[model samples]
Target: MTRPIQINNHPFRFLLYLEWILLAISVITSVLPHPSPRFASRFPELAILNLTIFGLMGLRLPTSNNLVKIIYTACGISLIFITGLFGGRADRLFPFLYIILVIRSCLIFQLPGRLSVTFVSFTLFLTTLLYRIPRYPLPPQAQEKFRFFTLSLALVFGLSLVFVLILMNTVLSERESREKLAIANEKLRQYALRIENQATLEERNRIAREIHDSLGHSLTALNLQLETALKLYQANPDKAQSFLARAKELGSKALQDVRQSVSTMRSNPLQDKSLAQAIDILAEDFQRSNNILLNRQINLEYSLSTEVNTAIYRIIQESLTNISKHARATEVNLEIIINRGSLYITIQDNGRGFDLEQNTTGFGLQSMRDRALSLGGKFTINSAFGCGCQITVDIPLGRLIS
Candidate 1:
């Protein structure tokens, strides 16, 4: 992409000031005394014409059309030629004007276009030098020195032009790369914010579902049992006592479910515990809450980062919670191992599974999947009706530590 040159802006004001400074120097030199008095009258008019063309070129610099840039460059070349042909001490001013043209070309063109302008500037300098060579005739001995001096000057001027072109190209390329990186970083930041908000919303919904599905049912059942006990208090004392006992049990169960939901909401689930310790605590809680027999084969031979540790803990926690809530199974298989430079985790249950095609995007399952993916891991689920559900997560250890 091209950037327009704003002469008043901070980026382009320095260039504007430099251009004016160069022009002032050229004008001052044109009015100074020179050995060649006949060229004096022509200097003032040539200087005025050169100044006018330079000002016009600056005004038209913000255009992107190649045709306009070519015309602008042509105008600069013609002015340089006229100044060299008639202005006193034109040799001193020719290089500066040509350099200025190259600078302007950079603002309007890409690398290929800039290179073309530099080549033309070098060629024109040579042509002007040759045209003015015969004006000062010298003896054979002095001519040899003059020719050597002339060739050296051309080489030096050509090198200077190439240097300026390369410098401008490097600066512009660096600036472009930085701009692209900044845009990419901004996009990433926005995406991260969206993901965070989505996660928060999903967590809120999950808690609401737990309260409605588990605690709500228990409290409703408890209320009915308490009402039944009240109704039978005078009719039958034994029946009323049994109903009161059942109501107390339901109330305790509802309280336990509420506690579990609150525990899940903790900011740091691990709480300074290692992955194995955290999993053991979770297994104990699962066994206490449900009748399922958990068979764990955990071999965490390698240490893990906090992020990985938390992810693993949450994935397992979420899986067990799902199994307890939905899976009517007597047994669960939990496996975790660091094998072949990767961490592998698999949680399977002998529960009556649902259709994978129809229930592929549950909130709990999605939360687990997102956790795995954020760490550059893979998460997959396999299940069918009457068949047990299986979830496998594989994460590269090298990626985690880095």
Candidate 2:
């Protein structure tokens, strides 16, 4: 025996096992004739043993290994032989044992292998019929006629059982295929949902950076200009008027920029332009409006995804905003270079910086870091309280470049 057949408990498999139990019950019931032989006294012990062996074919254990399957198959084949050889001439239903054997063989073996089992079953039934003919006290004419009818009926039943087994196998194979397809579709749906969630989170971070960069920077600059105007009210009357007028203009521009950021998220001062062009415009405006010295060197000459382009622009904007708010510097230098599919940005300012470890409570540094990370970039700040501040952002450009 190669191995035991193992199958899931589908309706068809249950029927395969259940059929043997029903067949055994049928044979045992018919063993003792009702008129002359009732259930208790008329049924022979040998016939009862035959029914027990047939029912054992359908016995299911908790776990069946190769050894268990081998033993089970041997017992089923043995029952067929025992029934034909010793089931007695009075038990005319011994041919039914061949039907049970053929069905069990179909479940365990392939087509060629099961055909071997079928041939053996036919030979055994014919030999048993010949053996019992002499024992039956029938004359030559009646014995010959009985042998012909028994062989013809067994042949017909065997072919019909083979056809039914083939149909059951086809149905079970189709059911297994449909179940695999359903599992694959569910995995694809879960993967799509995860991608959508990640995109939503990145968009939220982009918007936060935008609001902080444009509006926050403008408000800080406007507040500084107004303070200068207030102190110069009596000492320098004409300069105070000039400073106030510039503060009012900056306030109006800040309001417009905020509206533009909200109305069209993609519509920045950098609309329809390259990232370098956008950053240049931002630097010029900050220098002219605040009367601060700004120097920039940028080399972004390739097309990239909108999200990446937008992320880079906002990172620069947020860095500039933080400098304006906290850094009391005279000159700032911004350098951007793209090399080997990676963009590097470094901003250095000659300002009084704070301790990185102690003053770790603001959202400006955190916002810049978040923007860089969202776009597969890295952000690093190098500074001290007395010395100056240097901010570097490195972003990989291979994945999101357009």
Candidate 3:
């Protein structure tokens, strides 16, 4: 696999420049002052050639192909062989070749490939040592000098490899951490957006329910009174006058109710009443207005949090309004039960019912289900032609009943 090149930070770049400066100084010190014409001509030329290759490697050119590796290996082998031909005098610069090989291995290869390059470089160093020992005579003073050179070479190569590996691992670790944090932040944003949308939808449903319950019913009652007055005017003048007066009174009351419903629907109603109480008021008003009997059986007394209460009340109000408008029912039954950390509510009407599956897309039923789901609740409706409609809502207590 081809690895991307990363530009190092200022401190690391400074260290790299320092290494190149040191290599230049070593080459200059090894070559100057014209020691024997044959040694001077050949050795300095070879040292200059090796330094040039090191400079090229530092530029960080692309190495997706094996051409760069072949060039680097050939240069390394040539420098090692040339230094060996010069014997003990040139052997002092062997550490430079080791340093360059280790760095090139790290840049060109990943961990496993770097290890293979390291093993090969060490083998070449051993071969150079064995070749030199027989040609140079070991005097007592030169024995300690040879040992020092060997130790220095080992220290430079070993320490450089260890430090480079540590630096690469640290960079990889930091990159992975940043990626994970980015993913987590994205998920949090999505969750927050979902919550905001649900809140807006619940508020809209509340306003719609208030319109149907308070304003819609009153307007319908006023309309009925007006129709009655128009009929009575031909039969009896006094009765028609009384009916007209009642119609005017009903219209004025309805206008007031409309204003009140608009104001309250904009704000929160659950701040004044629990969810169950809100449902009870709605059922009672509906019962009184339509002259229909309501059988309410509630076993739960717990008050839900404000938002949860608002959602539940809207759902119940919508279900009852649908019954009043379309069901043509004489009696409706409402049952609420809370048990084992679950809130269960069922509303049924003894009226002409339509197919639940086929007519599932009706506005009132969809609104009720949407309200229940917004609170993390489940809603189910069951009905068939000529049979009563039943709606069941089950909400987890942890989510809404608290």
Candidate 4:
């Protein structure tokens, strides 16, 4: 990934401000009066150094992009060679610009890349020293002063260069850290959003199942009673009146059931009731609606999260629904157990089951599995053609502890 540079960072701004300050100092020292060499002889070089600094200031360098960076790096290398060339005269002030050139390099190069520039600077400094040494036509007195000034500048320049490189290393390190942290935070945000969406979908599915099971069953029975009342109106008015009364009662019950399901969807009543209590209510309702034997053995003394309670309720509710609609079973065994920090439940029916391969997605099996897994539980079904069906849900208590 491409890590973008932020010039506004405090460390980066500090480096920029230091570069400008060093530039100002180099300019002031270069223009200082030179008594021994004659000011007239050094004036031209000083003027050119000032003009070069001005030119550099106007040549806008990019803070990003590899191509622009390469061009800027070449410009810095050129400045180093120019400083070495003109700073040669023992008494001249131009060599002070070496610090400015080092600063220029610090702007463009990262760690270890500066070592290449450092090597180049050392080679050029040595060449300048050789040219300024005694073998030239200058007097020994001048040559001695030249060696002293030249050697000292080299030592100080090398030290200052290393220091600047070290500072730039810190800036680069901080930049990388900021980028990594930003990326990690972004990933965490996306994960949180996914979790929220999944919760919403599960809730919507639960509401849908409640409405289908409650209203569908009630409305179907009401319609049959009304049709029977219409047929008996001519033959037996009293019997027809009884059928009409039953239909009216069913209609009222269906309306109340719908409102109750909607209210439960809005929030969990199970929050006030433990899983055992919720399952007890579910068992009584299932037995009344389906006219099937529902044997219960629930004993959850400890409270689970509302989510776990809701999942357990929905799974049992959906399983009972599937049995009434398709299982053709008259009796079902419901058992809940806790052992070794695990919650296990078994819902088995002596219903006419079908082939596993052919009926893979029927009987609301997929939804029951999804609900169980969402609670960090395992769901399994055992059944075959003409045999009974059994659904087992196993959840570790560790998942509920949190």
* Clash totals in order: 0, 0, 0, 0
Winning candidate number (lDDT) = 1
Worst 10 residues of 3 by lDDT: 3-12
Error of 1 at 365 (Å): 13
Badly placed stretches (over 4 Å) of model 1 are 1-3, 8-13, 33-35, 38-43, 227-238, 256-402
Estimated TM-score for each candidate: 0.62, 0.64, 0.67, 0.65
- Considering every candidate listed, which one attains the maximal TM-score? 3
Q: Candidate 4, residues 70-108: lDDT per residue as tens digits?
A: 666666556645654554232244344444455455555
- Give the alpha carbon lDDT tens digit for every residue of 1-402 in model 1: 455456554345666778778777777777777777655636577766776677566754765677877887788888876776676664477787888888888877888889888999898889888876867668998999889989999999998998888887887788789989999999999999999999999788656544654565467567767887899999998988988987888799778778877886424457798888888977875764465899999997777788778778778877887787677889999999888888899999999988988987876787788878878999999998889899999998887662
Model 2 CA RMSD to the hidden true structure, in angstroms: 6.4
lDDT minimum window of 10 residues, candidate 1:
1-10
lDDT of 2 by residue, 1-402 (tens): 233344444235765566665566556554645554222323356666766756654544222354554566567667656655655432455556666666666555556646766677777776776665555478889977887887786677567556655764576567668888888888888988888888888777667667777778778879988999999999998998988998998899789987888787634656788887788888987786556798999877777877677777887887777777788887899998888888899999989988989765577888878878877888999899878799999888775579
Residue 317 CA error for candidate 2 (Å)?
Answer: 0.8
Q: 2 or 4: which has the higher TM-score?
A: 4
lDDT of 1 at 297: 94
Locate the minimum summed-lDDT window of 10 residues in model 4.
87-96
For residue 244, model 3's alpha carbon misses the true position, in angstroms, by 10
lDDT of 4 at 74: 64
Cα error, residue 334 of model 2, in Å, equals 1.8
Clashing pairs in 3: none
